[model samples]
Target: MIDKFVPSVATALAGVKDGATILVGGFGAVGQPDLLIEGLIEQGAGDLTVVANNAGYGRVGLARLLAAGRVRRLVCSYPRIPGSVIFEDLYRAGRLELELVPQGTLAERLRAAGAGIPAFFTPTGAGTRLVDGKETRRIGTRDYVLEHALHGDVALIEAWQADRWGNLTYRGSSRNFNPVMATAAELTIAQVYHAAPLGALDPEAIVTPGIYVDRIVHHPAGALHA
Candidate 1:
């Protein structure tokens, strides 16, 4: 029954409920899954807590969600530029809830979760604001801060190519977060421009195996950048 690949982002996210935590795989503009984001907006799934590297730029990426007011909180590692639509509005109204993580630690936390580790220690922000109120321990006179794993109900990712069975290959920086997020989410939805049959993609090229992906959404054509 799961043999055929889904064709739309909305269909892929049909099972996601409101208020779900989501790990969105993207580092800035490159790795984002646009179709799924658009579909989530259209579906009006609200009160979401989203985890991503950036909130997207302009109207082309995660900014769309901010514009739609669908997401309630964002956990990311970057600062938004002043006067940007979403950033400015959120700042002026104090409506946005943000949790800033150290860039490397954020990625590692997600990776650790996917690998089944509950937590890990990092020295990335030992005495900085990023470690405020966080637990710390000293190992051999050096303080290491604790960072917990991050998992989600669903993860939205974009890949360059995928198979009917969900094997995925990402292009460029899209490779960064998609693979890790795929494993950390209970359900992972991928939007790929091409969908090959299962086993068609060489084993070596399968960055994310089919087992991690719950649904494959095929979007053969669209303006990915605008």
Candidate 2:
């Protein structure tokens, strides 16, 4: 088996390039990969497009990347949070581009990309501004909007535990987006609290199969800033 572990966060994210599209796994910092984001900040690769559930809040995690002005565009369900002033400021100034999708729609798009589906139609945003300029069709009696699949150059995810082969197990609500995002990217990196032996983790308990994960970094205790 190929060893997927990397010595440090920087090395795990070493291949990320400028102008790359990144799928970030998180829901309000719960599942955010803080160390990976930190490495990205230090890497200083600019003009990135980030896809997540929300813009980073406070001064940590994704917020640090946004504050550094590294992200050129943001695709997410919620861009504004109580303390996301950096994102708001940049967006209002037109320095950052924003694509706001409905929460369910966003999840489906990512899932579709991983499933090899190029696009899918849904009634979620049929009559709203979300469908503006997009193709629309009637199915049965309801109108549905066509949303294209979303894929990324890299995926950053956080998990509670991982085996040597990269099989991942998430803790509680922190599992949000991580599993799906793992399959939607060309390269998938995971930050885990613990690293187990090849067969230590129960096969039935693994949330994300190792085949979808490319790299794993063990996160330091209390590493999360928010």
What are the lDDT scores of the predictions, listed in order?
A: 0.83, 0.91
Clashing pairs in 2: none
lDDT of 2 by residue, 52-159 (tens): 999999999898899899999999999998999888888899999999999999999999989999999899988888789999999999998989999999999999
As for candidate 1, its clashing pairs are none
Please write out the lDDT profile of model 1 over residues 1-226, one tens digit for every residue: 4553775566788978899998888877777887788888887789999999877777766888888888888888874743246755774697778889988998999999899999998888999987999999998879999899999999999899988778899887779888989999999988888878766898998899888999887877675421
Worst 10 residues of 2 by lDDT: 217-226
What's model 2's overall lDDT? 0.91
Candidate 2: deviation at residue 53, Å? 0.3
lDDT of 2 at 2: 83
lDDT of model 1 at position 37: 86
Return the top candidate by TM-score: 2
